[model samples]
Target: MGRIVAKVTVANPVDKSKSRTFDALVDTGASMLTLPTNWKKDLGDLAETRIAKVEFADQNIREIEICGPVSIQIEGFQKIFSEVAFLEMNTSDGMYEPLIGYIPLEQSGILVDMLGHRLKAAKYLDLK
Candidate 1:
């Protein structure tokens, strides 16, 4: 199986607020969307507060925060609200931009078609 890369836009849903739109790697392993600390200022007067520890690709664990509610929108799809983390913006290592993780996927009820590189709502499984 191959990987599918998707474009995601993260925005603070407030009047006259600026949003960050970029290409993000859809990582099912991640539980939430991680943003850069630089985005903190853009989040407006909202302060970025630490919440939990996050393990990076280097295997180093760092304190992560639930900065604010984010509006994650994919092309031709509805925007979803998610708790995000504020991390340092570094690209020297090979990691995707603002990793779109499972939390967003589940909240959005979207399943990715790995082979076809598409997004679709999942069908419910009934045990009955």
Candidate 2:
């Protein structure tokens, strides 16, 4: 599968007025959204904090800081989730600043097209 990248907007859940847009890597392997630790200031007053154990591809586990209840927006869909993780990355590598994970994609009804390296809204099945 090719890399899928998209622009994402993150806002403070309490005050929707505060928000920031950044490029994010759409990671199917990841379970939750993660942003840089420096973005905490822009996010403004994260409502919660906890330690999260993250295992990388090589099976290296690390305890990282997680903060929460931020609003995430992609394409035209948006949702205020209860939690998001934060970690530091090497800016020199030119990697995407934020990582959009599976949970957010599922929550926002987004479908990933690996062959096209893009994202699309999932169609809901209407039984009614």
Candidate 3:
């Protein structure tokens, strides 16, 4: 499967004014919304940070900073409450690639439509 991308808005729950929208990658393999480390200050007033160990696709493991209780809104979907995992990541040309993962998508009842190459609203939420 190729890459799937989405437009996402991340905001401070209490202060919606502190929000930033980005062209985020749809990465189901990732556990939560991941943003560039720089975003923490942009989406300010975040809660204290905690550390989590991450294993990359290349099999490299590193500890990263995780923060937030930020609101996530993937275009065409309802907003969902979630945290942001900040990784010092960049593309080959030095561009940051923010990503929205499975947790937020499931929270908003959105399903990946990889066959159609777009996101679709889920028929029903899972409780099982």
Model 1 spans > 4 angstroms off: 47-49, 93-96, 124-128
Model 1 weakest lDDT span, ten residues long = 41-50
List the global CA lDDT of all models. 0.71, 0.80, 0.87
Where does candidate 3 have its weakest 10-residue lDDT segment? 89-98
Q: Mind giving the per-residue lDDT tens digits that candidate 1 earns over 58-115? A: 8999887686666778665667876777777777775537777787777776788887
Candidate 3 residues lying further than 4 Å off, grouped into runs, are: 92-94
Candidate 3 structure quality by residue, lDDT tens digits, 1-128: 77788999889999988999989889988888888887788887888569999998899998888887888889979888878899887678867888788888899998998898889999999889
Ranking by TM-score: 3, 2, 1
Quote model 1's TM-score: 0.78
Question: Evaluated with lDDT, which candidate comes out highest?
Answer: 3
Ranking 1 against 3 by lDDT, winner? 3
**Cα TM-score of candidate 2:** 0.86
Clash number for each model: 0, 0, 0
Q: Write the per-residue lDDT of candidate 2 for residues 1-128, one digit (tens) a residue.
A: 57788888888978877788888889888888888877788878886578878998889888778887787887676554657888776698765468889888888888889878889877972335
lDDT of 2: 0.80
Show where candidate 2 strays beyond 4 Å: 93-96, 125-128
The deviation in Å at residue 48 for candidate 2 is: 2.3
